[model samples]
Structure formats: structure tokens, C-alpha cells
Target: MIDDKTTPCPFLGEMVVMFCQAYPVRKPVPKHLITASNPCAGKGYKGCPFFKDIMAGLGGATGVDPTLASRDRKGVTS
Candidate 1:
């Protein structure tokens, strides 16, 4: 059973990018795949396999920040 009372996954990158940072490498998740099973899409993500796969001792990392990702999409340059 999933717990509806919870915040979304922090491992999820930009709202538009739809990627999972839980993997060893960033995995691209399609918009269509954002179902109840998608922990990043809704609450109760702790039950997700990818979420559970997180290495032990890892904490306080939000992965790709949405603000930075949006800047990247806009073509940030020095």
C-alpha cells in the first residue's frame, strides 16, 4: 500500500525534464509514464523500486535543481 500523505520525490529533476536521479546515471522518464507507480509523480514514492534502490547513507540531495534546469533549457552561457 502507498501512503498518499507525503511529498513528491526530490530525485525528480525539472518539472518539464521528467527524469529520475535515483539511478546510477540520470534516467529519462517520459511524461506518459507518470502514473501512480511513478514515485516522482506522486506521494508514497518510498515504495518505488528506484527509490528503494538508493544507496545507503545518501541524504539531503535534491539532484538537479529545477531552477538550474530551466536555465539550461534556456541556453546558459558564460
Candidate 2:
């Protein structure tokens, strides 16, 4: 259940939590968002609060910049 408080994905135009549903499994992160292959790689689970929290921690879908989020995974920043 998405609410106004939910952040919309800047790329997909859907709620960040809904990203798991729309994307299902992880795919190659878009080049505009990331500069590496499989930068945002991960398996997605429906109705998983952990996934939601991760997305939120990454600044929600709307606020997230894949490049920046990838830093958390790779321990690198640009």
C-alpha cells in the first residue's frame, strides 16, 4: 500500500517499495544511474520489509542515485 509519504522512483515513476514488484529480480543498473555492470544487483522479494528498509535507507526510490547507492555496496565513492 503506497501512500503520499512513499517516495516515487525517479527512473521508474513508481513507489520505491513497489520496485521489487516492477523489477522483480535485480537487473543491470541503468548507465545514467550507475557506471558499472550489475551495480545494483540483488534479488527482490515481494512483501519483504527488509527490502523496503534497504531502499529507504538508500534514500528511497525518488531520492536515490544508483551511483551513490552502489557506493554502499562497493565501498567506493565518486
TM-score of each: 0.37, 0.25
Question: For all candidates, what are the clash counts?
Answer: 0, 0
Per-residue C-alpha lDDT of model 1 across residues 1-78, encoded as one tens digit per residue:
766578667686564446655545556666777887755666776566656545232343457443344344323321
Determine which window of 10 residues in candidate 1 has minimal summed lDDT.
69-78
Choose the strongest candidate by TM-score.
1
Tens-digit lDDT string for candidate 2 (38-78): 32343333245645666776667866654456456543333
Instruction: Show model 2 residue runs off by greater than 4 Å.
Output: 1-44, 62-71, 74-78
lDDT for model 1: 0.53
TM-score of 1: 0.37
Top candidate by lDDT: 1
Candidate 2 backbone clash number:
0
